[model samples]
Target chain A: MHSDLVASVRRFNRTVTQRVGALDDEYMARGRPLAQARLLWEIGPDGAEVAAVRARLGLDSGYLSRLLRNLENDGLVTVGPDDQLGGDGRVRVAALTESGRAEWTELDKRSDELAWSILEPLTAQRRQRLTSAMAEVERLLVASMVVIEPCSPNDPRARACLRAYARDVARRFDDGFDPALSTPVRDEQLIPPAGVFLLATLNSEPVGCGAVKLHPGTPAEIKRVWVADTVRGLGVGRRMLGELEEYAAERGWTAIRLDTNRNLTEAIAMYRSAGYREIERYNTEHYAHHWFEKRLRPPRTSGSRGHSDN
Target chain B: MHSDLVASVRRFNRTVTQRVGALDDEYMARGRPLAQARLLWEIGPDGAEVAAVRARLGLDSGYLSRLLRNLENDGLVTVGPDDQLGGDGRVRVAALTESGRAEWTELDKRSDELAWSILEPLTAQRRQRLTSAMAEVERLLVASMVVIEPCSPNDPRARACLRAYARDVARRFDDGFDPALSTPVRDEQLIPPAGVFLLATLNSEPVGCGAVKLHPGTPAEIKRVWVADTVRGLGVGRRMLGELEEYAAERGWTAIRLDTNRNLTEAIAMYRSAGYREIERYNTEHYAHHWFEKRLRPPRTSGSRGHSDN
Candidate 1:
């Protein structure tokens, strides 16, 4: 960790926050603190589930509730049971009143204006350069934001990634993907002793996943590596692969291998770059066009988390 | 401008604001609001002029005074006259008290921690990539933030830029620069109708300057085109050049030219790229090694601010 890198990041954080009007007492001159204004904007005209809004904003329950209460007192919003959904009565939802909807529209317009203000000062060429660099920074920051940790395959988030993965492959594969034709992966097999499933999430919303199965007498078998389109090309998939490899390597497996379809060119490239090499057929999975394997080093210490020094 | 470019910028603003903890009520869990904490941190142990602090933070006078009062009430700071410095009694300065200095140190530690937190999740390679991208974004954003507008040559900000420009040339020129040996520019000549002086500022601090003397019967002459080291190579010089040329052209001058020391290699390169071609000696400035000229396009409309369509 170079101190200069940290210093550069700190400088960026300061400059960006000031540039974005994050310090404004009344954002866009809307007569509300930035946090409250952002909350109102997030709630939107269509309303939102209380828990979902809280999670999206990463706000504590008490803080979120207070913000909601302020809007409620101002007659701009209402927080009540989500009875209209015909589901959980105890679950709350926040909806905008007529005035609130108008305010949200104004905020939307102001948001556009704010974006324009940053661009307005630069010439066309500089504008393009600024936005291009901004996109790169945003992509990399998002990649850093993604948290990959062991998750039960049965978890809804993990299931969602798997479903997405299947849909993606089906759309791209020549013969179309069919889980029925593939080797069955039992949920229990992905649990602790047998294997581990690593789910990659940004703000707790699953965006990618990978799994490794540690069979007693074989090299660990990697499977289901996938990254959501929103995070593609930002190295999320590569991070998932590394984490899956580490999971097996730390648990005493010496190597890991995965099969992939020819249509998955990017994944194959990533594997090759990550030190995986072509190998003889490791499995007869219906969709696999190539098999690749990599030998993993033993964990530096038992139960040690690899790459913690970073 | 592309709509996708604007969308990308908007996305960057949102993600960066959230990632930097800008929306937090108590930044770094300091109990004070973010604005207050930032103000305290900016004041520092050495103290600062109230006006300077307000300008740096882009805060309105009333709002700044309110923040100052709050800090005073909390016994974290003191706002008083500058009599100790033998300055104006009405001019106030804000200085941190013992507890405020301690709090500022805490905030500094927390800021480093926040930067580290962003890096901690990433692999060493990804960390490097992220920091590199962040530096790019920061540089470009600073470039975009620079606002160039016609200012009185006598203005303090403009004078500051001229002083910096002199110091910079003094160090770089082969024979060393002396203002007395150079062709003199008068304040009235760089004022409206005679000519124009453009000062480039970032958050009210001048970082660059350029001037064009629209002489009645000859080509417009450019002078003192310089950018501070802090913002060099970010296109501030180019923008200033463009703006100066536009100023001359809009006022009916068909061409602009300037003499530069050979040692100013980057400026010479920029001149060439900006359509300036080397010409025979234009004047007998003691240190000038090259002279360059460019034809300016007529303004699209009478009194039109060129490039506003962007």
Candidate 2:
């Protein structure tokens, strides 16, 4: 027989999907399909990129293009030059016409009604469960669906997650981070052979990244490890780390080391959990306001590779 | 400079870890080192195999042997007999001695104290945040870490998560679930090539899994998606589906669909948000549950992908 989980999960998916509205075809469909309506609302006062539109809606780009096309065909929106937003030739912009804006507002109200309709049936507690569960499901799904591809050191998503992480660090640290003062280990040093970069993807979107440097002698220095705001609780950071550690361990590195400003509580816990013991200060990486080290146990027979520690 | 989020996470972790006594050398020491304590605990009133202990801890066989030796050396536990649980030679077992029972009780008390200390801090709101965040972190971590390595089907973690998912549905359902009557697709069909199963993990622990089975000639079916109670809000089910859908897409399948009983409200909402739509009844496999479908978009380009309708 098949396992019991499939049935149970199917059951939960069914129950939740129903309560979450598995049946409503007419949600944003008062007069327009849901995606088109969403796109109309998303188009800015000036204009929006096909990419920006896609990002906001979290839709497949092709699917997004189709929705934009439908709205364009409806004479409610225009998709033409990206020049107004100063984009080069490759980027096309989509903007709502006056009529499109009016339609969008009306559709927006309808969307609200749709949300309310689904919300009306459940109790406050159920609503909380539904919302929280939906959110959690969304977050986790996004987290797992994200593949940690090895990207260039300067990849935009990787940089973006790092900047967010840095901005967050600057905000939290007693001495605000000066990218110059805080960014540690030379950038060139982080490039391959010495170290590698990893981009964390959720739903295939890059939301986080980490980096590690393998010096000729010292412990592998973990750096640039950060998770995106959208994926804070999805454990991307930890996975990135374990990957880095395993990668280091595979290389026969006897120890792994990382430092954080004292503010980072979770990183410390994570390191501790992975058999890392807190040793005294070890590195001079400028951004490393706090130093912690752990003796890496030998790798399992399962040889593995890939990483980012930041 | 360190990120505030990192700082908070670190602080939170420190607060919790200390409260939980997670890093104390004697934390699990229980009158013995952790290795010995673990052996004593594992060797219950009924004996267990040396192999099982190694497998459960992912310990090196030598490491386990050493641990067993320590326990034996202490005269608190013994591994004298290889009582086979099953037919395999790998099934050797270990049993606790009289002193081992007393030691286990002390360890149990310490563990309880640790749990309570970790729980006792802060107001209800913080506890809620901690548990919720822990749940969130746990789910995300579990979902990310879940190894989708092939198993012959009845893998216990998969089964446990599924059963938990089902029990939840049965409780939530207007009419309780009838596992025997409700399954639309049976177990053997969930095997690979035709179907894929995903298990969600946190801290290397499995918390959720979902499977999508190609229904022989019909459109593929989405079956059994369950998240552990510990990770329920971490958005695991959604991730499972996203990964499943992507996998299905790769298999050259189009128009993936699923069925659920009317009671599964959350699942329905997830489907709707992810862009699945309702159609007239499509299949009645054995369960013949309520059904839904979504048109598959084109094959993904190499660029990052976005989220789902469900």
Candidate 3:
């Protein structure tokens, strides 16, 4: 919100874009647009499902199809039905041709060179400092890029996050977690009116999720707050917590609570740091080791109720 | 350099480039490549010398000319010799036409929108965190991007740094600095065989300078160790100090010394932190209030003497 911050971001955008040669038409001098080059790289030697490439690149179907056509016309790629899994005719795959593989290799080498070019001018010490700072910036930028919004609990991305969350807890818990042994949460309970499921995504791929159950007459209960290892410690979990809390507060819940296993030490620390206090066990979930609660203030009059379409 | 650091930087490059839409042919959907839009933005409504724009963008003459020609062809800009300063026919300027100004305004608006788009998804608190991280990344990246290499003191860029250094000290010295009353460093003394002058540049523009004079027997004396205000606190001064020391050490000098005005507190602090020790007055320069000396380590056998063509 600060103008100075906005101005700083604009300056950063300019400097970074230029440094990375993002403005170049022929990326890495490969004689093709960057988008096409990136697509070729994404398809790779082993090839990729058309839908998978589209998802990873966040490219719309039409634009991606056009780029694929361009590469196909150049004799650098071939699009055909994926035959690896019994040839699902509706599911197409994009594979690099011999020339495309060569081009991809060249792009790979050039990418390393570009990275080195940025470091080469700097002294070894400055290079270290630059990279360290770069890592910090990348982590935080990723944190900012993550979008947390309401979603159907049964949506594929939401389901993916839930499966990841369960798998993660299974690995970390003292007694490995079992969904059958633990209290179950139905999709209907997480849908709007009764409650909501919040999905966190980066570039359209789900990385984290949290949900709240707005039980009648009782305080709203938070559940399944989880962040993927890839985005952990960048405060994705904290942001999810804040969003969940905001959601409950806006809908008139005065407090929220969640239970966690003792093995999830970092989650406990995060909860405490986020103003959630140690509380008596509020539920008899089989894996619960610690329970925490945070009182939420009533949403301001200016704050709108219902979901944010982030 | 750590491989992890390099890997992290590479990842940052990929993520940031995609987020900024740097790969788009039509930046901000303006129907022009990003390079052209950036050049148009650089030229501004008032116009700029063709040479200045090239320098700022670090674009080669051929590439810059082509971009200018494209804008010229589009009827958005005009390239002609300057007439306002008594018409130097050889000195060309690029000015926006009426339509070009309108396009510039649109580009400016889109730039703001682009900046906002990165922020709009987040809570205000996260926005603050993101912008703060961006500023840090920008500062460190700028520091890393700076290339310090030996240059002739008489070169225009070096001269510019010297002028800026003098102007800066003049404003800071308690009694004000007067070059006439101080020890004069001849250009030849700082141009090798005698010594070396190191110029620090961000992109192609000079931002800082340091020079060392290898006297016949005494310690090599450092002079005009200055960093522009824009890059002062990002460790440019420290890097310059290290480079100057390395230059002297590689050529058989075992120690270095410099005189400084007390009012230049940050420089004094940097020198102290960089292992410089207070010493007895070594010279009678009029405005100097502190004298410092640093013993230099011998350059390793693997280290080459003379200069690095950075």
Candidate 4:
């Protein structure tokens, strides 16, 4: 990273963190901390699974359980039964007390005030700058935080993100997406020594991903490269592609290939813009007519992630 | 509205709602209902005034109060603190509870899940469509919700929005904005019975605004027309201009004139596109070297708050 740009980014982060009070001991509110308030909100009026909450929040399971225990002790949340949360019929489902809901409402008001208040000091000109800056920060953070990892096809969030990507392709492609026509990413194929998939995250939210396979005799195929629209310009897609390429290169694959439809103008633009040369019908895969090939450069001896737009 | 289109929107809403379970009565992760959950998210962790909350949410005061009351009772929030809301100290405050922050986190997770779920069932093309539709809806709804009203020159939000516009214009404009040189919108000009101002909104957030004032000797004067960058290209600037023209015509002003710097390309494009002819300079306004004017048809007998975009 360029030092000046990195410094600017760091400054921006500091400014935003201060403005949003991100580093406050408790993220809740003036009266109550955010952790406790979040628990109350999650408990809701009925109940929620501890593990689900943990997964959703990306909180450590033990930390989440302790939080739940605290809420339960306060009588703001009640521990009860849930079929899905635990294997056995009896599971500790946490539900908010009536008072808990009211507490949440108050916090909701406070939080809005805080967000608006940040917008307050700035003249409309400043507000615009702030909004623009926030937008930029969101994009940059999401783009930078992407991590590509190989996982089984059944991984819930991975499957969810890919499905989302597929739906996106369907809407964009002239003929739409057909899962049947595309080769399904098999669970066995995604394992290390075989292949790997990568997931991108920002602020702990999954925003993008990509995958590459270790073919027995052919070039590794790159598939399912995607970036959430919210973070598109932040270069997540390019990064994902780069990661996939690196993974393939590590496995001795010299070239990577992929296919897309005409309707995907942006993706096509992204790929072409990223030095993916058009190939003449490399794959007869039913859904793929437009194929692209990228010859991977050898892994950097210095082990630094290569910085290239393509 | 087209029935099919309306049906499609409704279906979209229902399907999204059902799939996301945004309004699930019993997800019970938080005490607040779906609406409250959304409101909390909007509010963030800061705080908001009663009136602003009402305006943004488009809710009745009584209902808003009751919601606040519920939250307050549950120790999620407190209202009516100090007058820190605006420079004016009469506004009511709403703050969050300890549990409220926790609940907000839960709501945030749910929202992400919902966003994911909506994109999950579609092909990639469909996902693109959904994103496009969302962008359109955001634009159109914002455009439609804007209100053209007579405002005092010093209204803070209006002023803030205008200042924002000025700063943007200055930066984009070659000469840049010199507050000393720029023609300041005078109070007498914007205050009705002389002219009117319009503010654009989206879900109650003030996105943009414009003003028209009837100068006694000269053709009607257009001043203080500014749109937030967040809402640029949404046709708001055009609508505001048209409405100002109608306001001018209603006041028996034959031609409307405005002055702008040469560097403001978008504004110039808008002026040209809207049929305003550049002619010999009209006024001695310190900042304006190029002045433009447009002739307008007579106004309607009864004012229905409309302008001639045609």
> What is the C-alpha lDDT profile of model 4 across B1-310, one tens digit per residue?
2333333333332232222232232342455565565456545668777787777666788887887887777776777656553555767777666777777677655544434433333334434444444443333433334555655667787777777877777787666778777556666667886677766664445677778876566678788788887767656787778878877887777788898877677888899889999988766776666789999777767764534322
Cα lDDT of model 1 by residue, B22-130, tens digit: 5332455577776788889889889999988887878999999999999999999999898575698888989999998898898887878778878877768778878
Error of model 2, residue B213, in angstroms: 50
lDDT of every model, 2 decimals: 0.85, 0.63, 0.83, 0.64
The DockQ scores of all candidates, in the order shown, are: 0.51, 0.01, 0.34, 0.02
Q: Write the per-residue lDDT of candidate 1 for residues A1-310, one digit (tens) a residue.
A: 4688789888988888777745332445576866778789889999999999998888999999999999999888999998775679878999999999999999877777677777776768778878887887888788788999999999999999999989999999998887899888999889987889999999899999999988877888998988999888877888888888878887777888989999888889999999999999978888888999999888776676433210
lDDT of 4 at B193: 64
- Candidate number of the best DockQ: 1
Give all TM-scores, in the order shown.
0.80, 0.45, 0.73, 0.46
Model 3: per-residue Cα lDDT over B25-81, one tens digit each: 244447687679888989999999999998887799999999999999999999998
lDDT of 2 by residue, A159-207 (tens): 7777787788888777888877654556677777787787887545678
Q: For residue B202, what is the lDDT in candidate 1?
A: 87
TM-score of chain A of each: 0.89, 0.77, 0.91, 0.79
Stretches of candidate 3 off by over 4 Å are: A21-51, A58-132, A149-154, A165-198, A209-229, A232-310, B21-27, B58-83, B92-106, B123-125, B173-175, B214-219, B252-298, B302-310
| Cα misplacement distance, residue B46 of candidate 2 (Å) | 42
Which regions of candidate 1 deviate over 4 angstroms? A21-40, A43-51, A58-109, A169-183, A214-221, A248-296, A301-310, B21-27, B44-51, B59-106, B168-183, B214-220, B249-298, B302-310
Sort the candidates on TM-score, descending order. 1, 3, 4, 2
Q: Note each model's CA RMSD in angstroms.
A: 5.1, 23.3, 5.9, 15.0
What shift in Å separates residue B23 of candidate 2 from its native position after superposition?
A: 40
